[model samples]
Target chain A: MADPIHQFEIHNIVSLGSIGGHDIAFTNSALYMAIVVVGIAALLVGASSSRALVPGRMQSIAELSYEFVADTIQSTAGKEGMKFFPFVFTIFMFVLFANVIGIIPYTFTVTSHIIITAALALLVFLTVIVYGIYKNGLRFFGLFVPHGIPIYILPLIVFIEVLSFLSRPISHSVRLFANMLAGHITLKVFASFITLLGGFGIAGMAGATLPLALVVALFALELLVAFLQAYVFAILTCIYLNDAIHPGH
Target chain B: MATQAHTEHPGGKPQFPPFNKETFASQLIWLAVFFIALYVIIARLAIPRIGGIVEARRDRVEGDLAEANNLKEQSSAAMAAYEKSLADARGRAQALANETREKLNAEADKARRSLEAELNAKLAQAEQTIAGTKTAAMANVRSIAVDTASAIVERLTGAAPAASAVEGAVADALKR
Candidate 1:
């Protein structure tokens, strides 16, 4: 049986050179990332090439993705959040395509890595801080201060609020990364069970059908998780950005 | 498999692939590069085209609805004009029938009155002619009775009696 953890190992495709003590090289993760980017670009660019008044299949998907992201932004962040549409839209499509592409057998799951998801979550976190300060100036600190709180416990409440506010990026990144990592690992574990059971004989092979069925069901679940995680990530980004736009509530 | 993973990495012992700090730089750099590329493609090309299509369809549908409403108004106006003409025709036909009936009734009245007057004139003339005939017959009857009485007296005496005395006696008998 194949090692479940072996799938996550990043291999160097090309060595770019070392800077300081660290080696900077293109790896399989980078390759898949490039594939995701190109795939998204080609789908969008090619689908809109015809600009058909009545959309064909691919164009319909392209339009649906666009409207989906737009609606998510509008609902969570309101109209003023539209200025960050490009940024939010990019994050949504990138995570969504990366996740969906990773579901295919033998493909590297980009979102499964902590570093990648951390980078994405931190990007959202930093954008919220920077844009909130830029738009609201010192009033952005109002995000940590609640309205109608009594003066007696205000200090403790402020401390807790700051702590939770700081933990947002950690939770946001871990939620996606853990979901992908665990789902893939479980799928591999169940798949290996089928092989282990089948090696016993014809009766063992018959018993292997149970795990096979579970793996099939898990695959379907993972597919849902892939879409759901992307949605959660995008919506959370919108919510965080909303705090920037409207800091108090 | 664990031993293979250990050999796969060049430095020291192999760490868990995700936790390995060695490759973070490459992933971050590439993620930045590709994310920026995707952002440009989506913002520059995809949004404008899709937004334009939706806007155009909305305008077309609104225009079609306005034209449909205009046609309905025109049709209702035509129906009103047709109904007004129908009412006018019905009123004119009723007036024409009334005028023809009145003329026929007046002519019938005039013909009946003239015939009644002609019959009355004829009846009066007939009554006058009968009265004159009756008066002439009475005068003849008196003269004949006088002549017959004188002849009877002369025959009984074997000679003729006087005519005035006979006439006077016949007149006196006729009066009685």
Candidate 2:
């Protein structure tokens, strides 16, 4: 059997020569990202085409998707956090679409890559920094300093808080990337086992049914995980943004 | 069975492009491009239209409620005004009836008083006429008595008597 990690390979589909000492080749990841973005656009645009007072199926899906993100933001970040609604909503749709599409038999999962998730997480991190500084000025540093701590442990707590705060993007990106990576790998492994076992005989084919069942169950689990990861990503973003808006506690 | 990919490829190659520094810049570029585009589309198009729908529905409902309340107030005011006018009309009718009754009563009283005065005047005149009649009759009775006394004395004594002495005898007998 081939390596399971090979499926995650990002190869150059359109090889563009190096620009500014950098390879500007278009990749499978890029294609899938475009697909996700286009898919999202098609959903929203198609759903809103009728603009019906009573929503049709497409419109209901679009509106429900919108309200889902909006409600998540409101619950996690409160009303003031709505200024970042577009940012948070885009992240959610992008990740969710990517995760769902990735579950298809041969489609690329863009969110499975650390670079993509990291870039997204970094965007949020930067937004928090810029917004927190702009909103609270020098008082934004209060995030590192927890209130009601004794003076003796204040410095230690501040250090730990600052470390954890700086590590947000790493953990956030890794969580999504790892879940996708692991789920895809396990599915590939079980699938290879079933195929390898099926080649032996009627007895081998019968034995293959166990792994086949597991693969089916795993696919279902991966689908659930896909949605869960996206939700977690969005809610975390809201929570981080809430910190940006109110950095005191 | 699925199409077997990478069957001849070496295992444990560690060719994960995500960690590869070569593709980071390009991926970042496209990601930024797609994200910003989506953000613009969502913020500019979808959310606002949906918000407008919700807001319009809310406004319509509120306007309907307000119109209902206004109609209720207007109807109640009309009902109150109708009741007030009905009461006013009833009072006026009652006043007119009372006025008519008082006027009739006054007229009846005047008529009764005038009728009583006329009757009293007629009664007084009748009483005066009765007294005059009684006085005349008494005078006739006195003269008749005097003539009767003179005739009786002449016939009994077979001689004629003096009229003045007979009259005095008759008046003395009447007085007794």
Candidate 3:
């Protein structure tokens, strides 16, 4: 069988100048991210420029994505949190597009890497903390304090709350990265079976076709997971923003 | 599928890469830079455009509704004016009809009074003519009576009675 981890090797696409004795190199993943960002910008701008009273299909898709993020924010975080709608919407689209693009035959799955997902989760964590502190001043640290607890158990409750608070970035990043990595690994394994079994005979070739069929089926399922991961990420961000805005409730 | 594998390393020791904190920090810096760029685009460009579009749409809808309400009110006012004019015409027609009836009534009353006065004058004239005719007939009757009595007295005593004697006899007969 082929080495599964070999699929995750980062290929340097462009080498820029060194920054502080470290190579500031750009890779295929960075290129794809840039492409996703540009594609989204063009889609939104082109879809909405017409501003038709009756929308075309592309416009309808753009509007649906907007309304989806808007509604999710309103429901999860209330009207005051609607200001984050565009940010959340862009994040969802970028991740969803990147995951879908990776499913193509020769594309790299950027989101399968822990580094990418961890960076995204870290940004969300920092935003929540920084914005909360900026808005509420010193009172933001009170998020670790649970209200309505018995005075004697306050210390234990604070400890648990702090632990859970620290775990958000790990859980958020792992959920996306693990799902993508497992799905790609499975596809790679099944694809290897087709090559290995085909060398034997006619029956071996027929058996190889079975793994090929399974790979096809799993590919379809992975598409759904890609979209779901993006949605899950956006909703979690909204929930975290809510905690920042109103900590106790 | 569980075939035996040969390894260069005899012991089952896992091979791992060196953990460099500088590399991790460099990755973190790149991630932070990318995140800041994304944040700037979201805050400055995309969201404001979307909000402007929404606000413009809302203003257009409200303006349309306001215009429709104004037109409805104007139509109602025009209908009210039309109704008022119709009522004014009906009032004028009623007043004209009452005036025409009064004129006819006054003309009829004047004609009746004139006819009654003419008839009263005619009756008084006829009564005066009847009194004159009775007076003439009385004179004729008195002359005839005198002539017939004188002729009878002449046949018995050969002379006619005088006018004064005749008058005295007549007056005495009327007294009896």
Over the stretch A1-249, how does candidate 3's per-residue lDDT look in tens digits?
A: 885555554545777767777666676666666666666666666666777655678766766777788889999989978877767876787678778887886687767777778888887898899888888887887888877889999999889988998999999999998888788878888998999999889989999989999999999999999999999999999999888887764
Ranking by DockQ: 1, 2, 3
Model 2 clashing residue pairs (backbone): none
lDDT for B54 in candidate 3 is 57
The sequence of per-residue lDDT tens digits that candidate 1 reaches over residues A110-150 is: 99999999999999999999999999999999988899999
Candidate scoring better on DockQ of 1 and 3:
1
lDDT of 2 by residue, A81-191 (tens): 889888888899899999999999888889888889998999899999999999999899999998999999999999999999999999999999989988998999999
Query: In candidate 3, which residue pairs get closer than 3 Å at backbone N, Cα or C atoms, i.e. clash?
Result: none
Higher-DockQ candidate of 2 and 3: 2
lDDT, residue A7, model 3: 54
| Weakest 10 consecutive residues of candidate 1 chain B by summed lDDT | B1-10
Q: Residue A224's C-alpha lDDT in candidate 2? A: 100
How are the candidates ranked when ordered by TM-score, highest leading?
Answer: 1, 2, 3
**Which stretches of model 3 miss by more than 4 angstroms?**
A1-8, A16-24, A46-60, A82-86, A185-221, B1-34, B116-176
